[model samples]
Target: MTPAQHNTPAFHDLFATHPRLTGLALAPDGTRLIASGQTSDADGTGYVPGLWEVDRAGDDGIRPVTGSGPGDFAPAFAADGTLMFLSGRDPGERGGTGDVALWALPERGAARRIAHHPSGIATFAVAAGADTVAYTAALLPGATDAESHGRLRRARKDAKVDAVLYEAGPVRAGGDGEPHTFVRHADGAPMDIGGQGLAGNGDTALSPDGSLAAYTRAPTDQAPDTNCVVVADAVTGAERHVFSRAGNQYYHPVFTADGSALVCQRQREETHDTEWRVTLVAFDLASGAETDLLPGFDNWPWPGRPLPSPLPGDGTLWFTGDEQGHCPVFRRDADGTITRLTALGAYGSLCVTPDATTLYALRGAVDGPPRVVRLDVAAPDQEPVFLTAAGGLEPLPGTLTEVRTEAEDGCPLRAWLALPEGASAERPAPLVVVPHGGPQGSWSDWPWLWNPWPFTARGYAVLLPDPALSSGYGQRMQRRGLGGFGEVPYRDVMALTDAALGRADLDAARTAMAGWSFGGYLAARTATLTDRFRAIVSHGGMWNLEAFQMDTDMSAYFRKLFGDPRTQRERYEADSPHLDAAKVTTPVLIVHGGEDHRVPTGQALGFHNDLRRLGVPVRFLYFPDEGHDIGVPNHIRVLYETMLNFLDHHVLGQEWRRPPLL
Candidate 1:
């Protein structure tokens, strides 16, 4: 299809309408596969869980394993034909307050609810022997007298009783609860006991005999130090610190079949940011010595992108990395020999069958929805078998052009610029500076299945940059602007705007900044720092770090990152843009989800109040039913449409059209 056809209202409407596909898995024997995703209807109504199964034997015959409903996900299999997963509903088929329950289905038909809870199940995995299942569950927040923060529980395959094997959190020792907690199981319950540090930011692996478990533990909170890996006795829960480096975050721990060695992905911290040097390191469990597996290979750094799943017999390790321009699958054998597995464009969320012969991947391009595919590792170049075709959304065609410019400090910055179909580079077009959330996270060229397109389709030039704090580059580059949120990143953005102004196709004077979470904070600060932009939008952002630290869900995490406000009160006061509210002259829009625990609504309301007090042009929109990310379609449409009107009034100098107040 032509580029214009791809950007049609029907195409954009399809994406706006469809529920996103997420989380894919393969059955133990490698014969069957399961996928957990979401589906939404045309009016943005039908939001439901999706469970699908596929036969790897021929063309990856894919079919829906469960009928469409409100909640279903975290799919795993007990054996070849017995599928087990989590559904976000009770046995009565009623939607509940907490997570969904455990459900089972035979390979041939409909699913039946096996377990339900008032709190909810976070995740689950069946043991290698297929006799038991181990899962993680957390008590719902705001529940009175909740005993557990999060715990590891286990149940037999044929038994109805579930028992808690280990529990952690609800830590009241340091005058507050722990930063974060999660249970990682190497195999299944009883024998599968493993624990990581606060962040729930680690990986776990079990030995072939299931006798040992290896895991990585990194400080999940804002603490700049404390990253390590521990090997533990599977039955006893005794942990031995096998590997650790100060300031380096080790993740994705995997064990060799024999359990003699453990392999993990390591990224060192230069300052506050994690550099993207994800190399495989082999830790000899006996000697505790580590060896680099692929020392020079660069892996793409993106959240929710699954790392390479190690195979049992073949000394090869498989992973996804940016090859040329797209993220393709590659395999590196024991001798350090690397081979490309799939020739298809950017792919992610890879899962290998228990037998390790077949690989399942989500494959797609910059303009379309991703489809699940099965690839034969033995035959690298053969056409992949399409397991399921993604419905609803059509691809939006446009060329992804790379733009690089130097920050004010002379540091090089990178961005992706996507222009409208027939838009000429010679004419000036409105621009949007879309900063990604994790200030630490970098924007990749892969299509954002949920964002930026809605604005781009309206003929706006979208500029996404990997600023100083963004990961992927080395540690030094990642930490260049440490503790300089208002200083360095702002300079980089200004420099980017300067470069954009030089481009005849970009209307630099008519630009706006938009972002979520940390990105939102930066956008709000940008409006106060300078009046260069016509408008700004903040989603789930904090105006004051000190206030946010005290009010946020993970206060300890915030303290670690920004430090105790009592001791560093000056830093908090100086860094906060809310302190400089009088300087904000540009029109601003703030959108927040009332249910967001990360950044509470108080932050948005406080800023909105301050903006009004300062006589600044500002608007506040709240989504009461949603959390950090607003998932409801009507809310999303309202948000985008309101944002567009705000941009139109300022950037296009159109008359102000007020949207319905939330």
Candidate 2:
């Protein structure tokens, strides 16, 4: 491909029109693979997802299962070779007032609506063995039936109060929405969980026999949310808690092949100072017995995903985890012998053929977008083969290079450096270092959000460093930045940045840094410590440590980090950027979603006010309609455009151009 072919499009043309590939599932026969990808009208106004059926070898090419405009997603294959998915078709035709409805497509003919509800399905599960289907729908606090729930919703809209009664912690942002009632279709019509709806994140997992269903529920309003595994009869909806411990959080429950026990990931806290360690466990229903699976395994299941793609009768369950810098897939035997199946890159949306031998997943790396790749878990030595080129993105504007360095504590750190194609020794590129969030997160995999292509397209080299808190690196590496959040991680990022700058093609003088969430907090902290960068853009950043610990929906969780704001003044003062804002000389760009409950809009407001009060050059890009992550397509476009403009002006010394909406 020509270098020019890699040219990134204009902000408007790029953000709204860029493709998205997700929801990968394998047909029972393993003859075809199903996936959902983005499709937009000529005007880009009609953005939607269309399903594709891909051949195993992709020799015959991909075939479209849906036409256009309708937002189709979450492709789940049933035992009978039926490809079931959710779509936002017309309500009159789908028999629902809400936009989205669950529809099923048989192997031979057209698709049919399997379920529809007014509140729309937040999440759903299709039983692997039986025909039972379970879905979760949003319900009011005290309502029982669909009609009363619908009426309560309408009344709230009519009253225009926009007020929520919060007698609990974690009301918004990162927290799950009010207890979604599980609507299951087993005996006859769909039914809710019980008299009191289960307070959980709708992580529904059904047993192979289709008799029992397991889901994760947050048991209380404590500072740190603890998930309790709930197992219930799929048909009767009679549920009870299983294998829960007072000091540990349990989630990601799935039934064993025999359906006699449930296997789940457990996060137990041995001490307050150390990081949480994730382990796999097998819980027997009859004896209320729990046995640890893969005893030494430290990788987090993340999002409560129980097991990787399980072959129908396969005794072992497979999964994905990060080791070193790459996210690889691994499988565990009945004896808890865990074997690594993949060597490099990151994998997601794992699906195994019913025969259980072949595994298919969406694989991506630092330089590439998401792709459908095939692997043989049984043949763990074999490398994964890219199955369908359907998810291949337009050629990137830059090339990727992996940089490695060591922290002061001797922990190995790495980062992905994306440089513009034309960048060279003579034509050095400005640097845009993007520290990742999750403090517990990593840049080891592919993600469309905070993608570095936009910056590289603008003649900038982007640095995505995997620091102390990043995953896939061992539990010991994770423990490095536990409560401090500043020492080792900061050093690792700078160490890699220093290593990257040693290259002739990168310029340290025209440098800037940007990140969101934890990365945003790091960016704010980085600015206070050093004037190494010309500009710093912090999105949903935590500048004021004390206020953030108190105001967020996860105040309880943050308290685990900062402790009591009044008592832990030393940690807060040393770590919080707001405490030392006067030391920041770099131009600041604060971007925040007003509805952000995780970081909260207050963090951005207070930081911006401080920047302005101290006479520091600052600009605020606040989206009132957005949350922690910008959901609106238009707002996303504006987000990237605004960040691009900010960097272009401050780092490249280019003529500042205002974004359209601004």
Candidate 3:
């Protein structure tokens, strides 16, 4: 089909109805490839999740690997074409309990479960040789006092049983916590090397020989200022501080072929914005001295561009960087000289062939789904081989325009405006002000994977403003809303809305606010703070700080954001949206996952109950089987449809005037 025909409404309908492709793996021999993705088939009135596999060769072999429904992922190829992956029997199961099992794919069409768990498996990984399978399974409540612990297990290719290697416990002074570990086994059973700790998020890298491990560790209490690389001997589990930094976060560590040094991406803080630079630093294992191979490498200055993966070689690294608005691959030689490789679109997760002659990359835009591409870096001018089209997904044509507006205090705030095609300046459109989740995170140009398009298609304008606490800027800007959660960030959002309303095409009276998590908290708080918005929608948001502190899973994390609620009771009370529920005049809709352990279901229900008691117009929509965010396609459809109807009723004053619960 022609490119234009492939993007038609009929094509979009087919594409949206299909499953999404996620994890990809290349075999050890580099001659074979295994891909794992989900599919949904209609069963009576609903759809069920299924697993599928595809062979890169063999007459375009693509077929279902599992017979029944459940979600399957994390597919890896074992030695001699044996495939191993995780699967579950029920898609709706949660809280560590469900029939999740480890299955083996002997070939393209045959599969069988080898290990079964009454609870469920969260994640799994297979060694390169495939003889050893390592996985992390959640121990159910009866099995442990802690809510959840990632227990590591390994199995042999010939053995009929599996053995527990390590179980993650609470963080000890020098011991590993949960298995944030990445296993790279060259021979024998997989080694137990890493675990979750301060390591910024869960980025871990193994040495070339699988004898050493390098990872980043951040401070637990606060948003980490700087993270250091801790190198440990894989055999003895002996650890040593290899590299350290003061205020920057070093992420995605990669070991050199010789295992003498490591390369990582460094994010440095600046005023009003954070600049990302990729530096190749070589750390001497013996001397513990870090030498900068190449410093100050900007991965394309434009927002949302990720640094290219380091090429697999010693003294030479192949990585992607954005330069002059286009993403291109660059080769940084041992001598610090760099050369451009390919002028492809934004790409990530570079998988080099075992021979190191070719590289496989995924390229796409935010609105555009990812497509796999195979590039022969040796032939720099040759066109890349396209393995698949984002499997029928079309790119939603839109542009994120950045605008700087002054806050009430005259501080410059950054905002992104996504304008729909054929929109005019004269036609005033309803505005949907979307605040980001992290009071500390910035809104970039990443494609909106959710329902922003549906809103824009219906002639609404979406506004995203980066308040004082946003991180892309610098430390000072991020700290601006540290304790001013209810004050400065709220004001910044309002000022930006007022500025947008000043535009001829923005309908000031038809504005609404929506957010998820912290953004949800802001939206709820804003409704009470002002009567400007006609409606508001909050997803996984906090209602009362006091209740949230007691009910939410991350009480310790919240303590840092608002201080200890016991000692800072007045401060928490002052910053809570629940305190002013009676003042919320605008109609509000609360959406949440029933099993959301992160924010907890109590927060959403508490707000709904309070609003009802106050005689305010509000409605609650809960997905019983979902988590912090809605993942199932059918549920997402329901969420978008409900939101659209809610917006239509309030912003357009059409058909329905108010929800039944409201």
Q: Which candidate is the best by TM-score?
A: 2
Model 2: lDDT equals: 0.74
- For residues 527-638, write the lDDT of model 1, one tens digit per residue: 8788888889898888977788778866655665666778877667767888888899988999998888888889999899999998888888778878888776666667
TM-score of 2: 0.92
Which order, best to worst by lDDT?
2, 1, 3
- lDDT (Cα) of model 1: 0.64
For candidate 2, write residues 318-435 as lDDT tens digits. 8777676667778887666788888878888787776677788878787677778888866664577886663334566778888887888788878889888788878888888999
lDDT by residue for model 3 (97-214), tens: 2456666666556566655443444455443332544444333222331122323221222464333333221122222233244343434433445444522354565564556666
What is the lDDT of every predicted structure here? 0.64, 0.74, 0.60
RMSD after Cα superposition, model 1 = 6.5
List the candidate 2 regions with Cα displacement exceeding 4 Å.
Answer: 1-8, 40-47, 66-69, 94-99, 158-162, 173-177, 180-187, 195-199, 222-224, 268-272, 301-304, 308-314, 390-393
